[model samples]
Target: MNTLSYGLLSLLSFAPLSGYDLTQKIKPLWQAGHSQIYPLLASMEQQGYISYKLIEQTDKPDKKEYTITEAGLAQLRQWVEMPAEHPVLRDELHFKLYSLWLSEPQKAKELLYQRMEFCQSELDRYNEMLGGNETLREERGESHEPKATTFGRYMLIRKRIMDMESSLQFCKYALEELEI
Candidate 1:
């Protein structure tokens, strides 16, 4: 299955959601736009992974409330148990670092510092969300179907926090190594 299929399945496994809702939910985690999601949703439905209901709305356009099917759940289980596809590690920042010998030390230092800010910003956002999740668990006692569905995301966000922390540390070391 494609990335979009997995994403849509992951969302629908939790609860029925409209296309707009799916787009909003994935904004911070992935870079999908509406143009990509709608088409993929149609394709997944064709593959017997998902189905939807048209909800009547007087205030706005009708919505497709999508849900996962038995096949989708099976697919999701297989996806979880199967080894991950080789992860991609492409980043423009790495290219910039590789080209550092041709750039001025002061300029490189500035760029590295900018990266520090960027990583920290992402770290801070995730930290805030982690805290919020804790509060939610305390207040509402997160359980049932939603908990089962969203657990992967909770693990994902925590892993990303480690990534950001490591990135920030790399920036600091790179700057000091440059002696700038």
Candidate 2:
């Protein structure tokens, strides 16, 4: 249930996107790396969560466009309505924290500072993207001006980014407190 496959299924609920398009959209927000996304897509298909059809384009090679099945839709609905779980921090971060004891305190502090800077940059990018950028809508082939539906989704993403930023800030403070 922790697999990002749920997010992929939810994205397909909006529209059938190619795996490439899905990866592109997800990269800026979620941690759906290309390596993770394609394999998950294959697994979802195998498990009957989704299905894809080859879309033949006049100007391009055929693409696999993914669509959610009824079962997938049911699962998505259940997932969305489920109460939120406590966030599971990434294992990499935990590993880095553990490694702090092995490094010079100043070096550990520098590492945390670097992480904080990265988080800030990510937050800025998320904010920019959510700031009524018409380009994304256009890229999605949306003809109308961005609507409430799109904006609402963007807001949800923005909230998640903000949460991550807050967590990063907290980590930064904790690192400083540790004098590391």
Candidate 3:
């Protein structure tokens, strides 16, 4: 199985989710779509790594919610214990930034502005998600340390928030250097 296959299993270990749900949840962490996810789900099911239950819906087509099996859990545990490969970032913005010296000052300023906007939007989305998590915890009278089931998600969102904030600051500094 590929890395995405393992990613799907990791998500299922958190909770049973439909293919659509999995796609949305994995978007921030992995670049995957329904086109890729459905086939992998099918293959994992055949390999006895996962199983699904048909979920009936009143207004929409039925869906299959997938869950990880014991075998998948074992595989996921082993994978986690193994050293991970270095992360790969495929952002087009990086290429643009690398060649930024070739651009006019105004053009470079525009690039930084665009990146700032993108970072702000992502930061806002992550902040909203974090707010929702906090609200849910308060409603349940839970502690700051999230339950095991949600600990990974909580920490991941916080990390993304910090990343976006740092990006925005970088953009600001770049703009200042350009005297924008």
Candidate 4:
């Protein structure tokens, strides 16, 4: 299944949610466009992978909340067991680092410092996300269930936090190594 479809299923596996709610839930990891989601929702519904119910609002337009079908659950379960594609990190900063050998000592030090600052901010954001997950897990009565995506989300965010810490260390070490 496509990433969007699989992503939709992963979220729906938790609870039924409006598209707007889903977008907010997914914003941290998914940079999906607003235009991309609505059409995909319709397509997933048409494919019998999902379905939506309309909820009436007193002073607002109706909301379409989507949920995964049994078929979708089966697909998700199978997909989870399959080996995932290797992740591709398209980081501009990493590209810049690749050419650090060619940059002047002063320029390289400046770039490394800038990267460290960015990593720290990102680390803080990921830590905040981790705290948010703790609140969510507490509310949901979360357990270490292998089947639950909450566990996966928590792990992924933790990995990012660790990655940021490593990145910061690497930058500091590079500065020292070059005596810059």
TM-score of each model, paired residue for residue: 0.85, 0.67, 0.88, 0.80
Candidate ranking under lDDT, highest first, comes to 3, 1, 4, 2
Clashes of each: 0, 1, 0, 0
Against the true structure, what is every candidate's RMSD? 3.2, 5.4, 2.5, 3.0
Error in Å for residue 25 of model 1: 2.4
Q: Tell how far residue 59 is off in model 2, in angstroms.
A: 7.6
Candidate 1: global Cα-lDDT?
A: 0.85
1 versus 4: better TM-score goes to: 1
The local lDDT score (0 to 100) that residue 88 gets in candidate 3 is: 88
Evaluate residue 113 in candidate 3 and report its C-alpha lDDT on the 0 to 100 scale: 91
Against the reference, the lDDT scores of all candidates come to: 0.85, 0.78, 0.88, 0.85
Residues 10-117, candidate 1: write the lDDT tens digits: 888878899999999888767899999999999888999999999999999889999999999999878867777787877898999999999999999999999999
Error of 4 at 128 (Å): 3.3
Report the poorest 10 consecutive residues by lDDT, candidate 2. 139-148
Q: In model 4, which regions exceed 4 Å deviation?
A: 58-60, 101-107, 132-149, 178-180
- Candidates arranged by TM-score, highest first: 3, 1, 4, 2
